[model samples]
Target: MKWLWRSIASLALGLGALGVVLPGLPTTPFLLLAAWAGARGWPQMEQRLLRHPKYGPVIIDWRERRAVPRKAKWMASALMLSSLVSIWLLPAPMLLRWFLTLFLPCVALWLWSRPNS
Candidate 1:
C-alpha cells in the first residue's frame, strides 16, 4: 500500500513537473495530487514539495483555503477555451465536442467560484 502510494506520488510529481513546461498541461492539480499521495506514503517527499520555492505557496494556499489564484483561474479558462476551439476545428465527433462544450464551462465556473488565493 505504501509502495502504491509512493508510485502514484512519483508519477503525479513527474507529470506536474512536465506541466510546468507544457502549455495547457495544468501544474497545480497534479502537484496537489502528488502531495496528497506523498503524505500517505512518504512524509519526506511531502515536506519537500511543501517547501518548494515556486510551487509551495500555491499548494499551501490550496490546502489552507481551497483557494485558487485569480491568475491561474484566468489562464486555465483561456486554455480550456482554446482546447475547445481546437477540438471543434478537428474532425472530432459532435457528441465529444458537445460534451466538452458543456463540461469545460462547468469546470471554469467551478474554478471561478473558488476563493482567490
Candidate 2:
C-alpha cells in the first residue's frame, strides 16, 4: 500500500513537472495529487513539494483556501477557448466536438468561480 501510494506520487509529480513546460497541461492539479499521495506513503516527498519555491505557495494557497489565482483562471480560459476553436475546425465527429464544447465552458466557469488565492 505504501509502495502503491509512492508510485502514484512519483507518476503525478512527473506529469506535473512536464506540465510546467507543456502548454495546456495543468501543473497545479497533478502536483496537488502528488502531494496528497505522498502524504500517505512518502512524507519526505510531500515536504519537498511543499517547500518548492516556485510552486509551494500556490499549493499551500490551494490547500488552505481552495483558491485559484486570477491569472491561472484567465490562462485556463484562453487555452480552453483555443482548444474549442481547434476542435471545431478539426474534421472530427460532431458528438465528440459537441461534448468538448459543452465541457470546456463548464470547466472555465467552475475555475472562474473559485476564490482567488
Candidate 3:
C-alpha cells in the first residue's frame, strides 16, 4: 500500500501547491494530509515538506503543538470575512447569505481558539 500512499501524497501536495496561489483554496489541510501520507510512503518527501520555506513551520507547529500561527489565524479570519462580504454582496438568495453569515462566524471562532505557535 506504499505505492497507494505515495500517490495520495503526490496528489495532496499538488493540491496544496495550488491552494498556495488560489484564493479560497485552503493549503494547510491539504499539506497536513500530504505530510501524513508522505511519512508512510516517502520519507524524503515528508522531510522536504517539513523543510519547505513557507509551509514547513506551519506543519511543524501544528504537529508539535496543535497550534496556529497568529499571522495565519488573522489572515484566515480576514479571508473568511472577505468571502462573507462577497457572498453578501452577490445576488444569491437571502437564505444562502444568512447561512454564510452564521457559518463563517463559527469558523472564525474555531480559528481564534487555536493556540498561537
Candidate 4:
C-alpha cells in the first residue's frame, strides 16, 4: 500500500511538473496530490515538496489553512472551464462532454470556496 501511494505520488509529481509547461494542464492540484500521498508513502519527497521555493508556500497554505491564493484560483478556474468549453464544442463523445460539464463546475465551486491564502 505504501509503495502504491509512493508510485501515485511520483506519477502525480511528474504530471504536475509537466503541467508547469503544458498550457491547460493543472500543476497545483497534482502537486497537492503528490504532497498528500508522499506524506504517507515517502516522507523525503514530502519534505522536498514542502521545501520547494515556489510550490511550497501554496502547499503550506493549503495544509495549514485549506486556502488557495486568489490568483491561482482564477487561473485554475479559467483553464478548467476553457478546457471544458473546448471539449463541449468539439467533436468529442457525448459521455466525455457530459462528464466534463458535470465535473468542472464542481471543481470551480470547490476552488472558489477556498479562502484566499
Per-residue CA lDDT of candidate 3, range 1-117, in tens? 999999999999999899989987878889999999999999999999999998899999999988998877888888999989999887889999999899999989998898998
Task: State each model's C-alpha RMSD to the native.
Answer: 0.7, 1.0, 2.0, 1.7
- Against the reference, the lDDT scores of all candidates come to 0.95, 0.93, 0.91, 0.93
Question: In candidate 2, how many Å is residue 30 off?
Answer: 1.1
Clashing pairs in 3: none
- By TM-score, the candidates rank as 1, 2, 4, 3
Model 1 weakest lDDT span, ten residues long: 52-61
- Which candidate wins on TM-score? 1
User: lDDT tens digits, residues 2-106, model 1?
Assistant: 999999999999999999899889999999999999999998999999999988888999999999999999999999999899999989989999999999999
* Model 2 bad stretches (over 4 Å): none
Instruction: List, residue by residue over 81-114, the lDDT tens digit for candidate 4.
Output: 7888899778999999999899989989988998
* lDDT agreement of model 2 with the native: 0.93
TM-score of each: 0.97, 0.94, 0.82, 0.87
Please report how far candidate 1 places residue 117 from its true position, in Å: 0.7
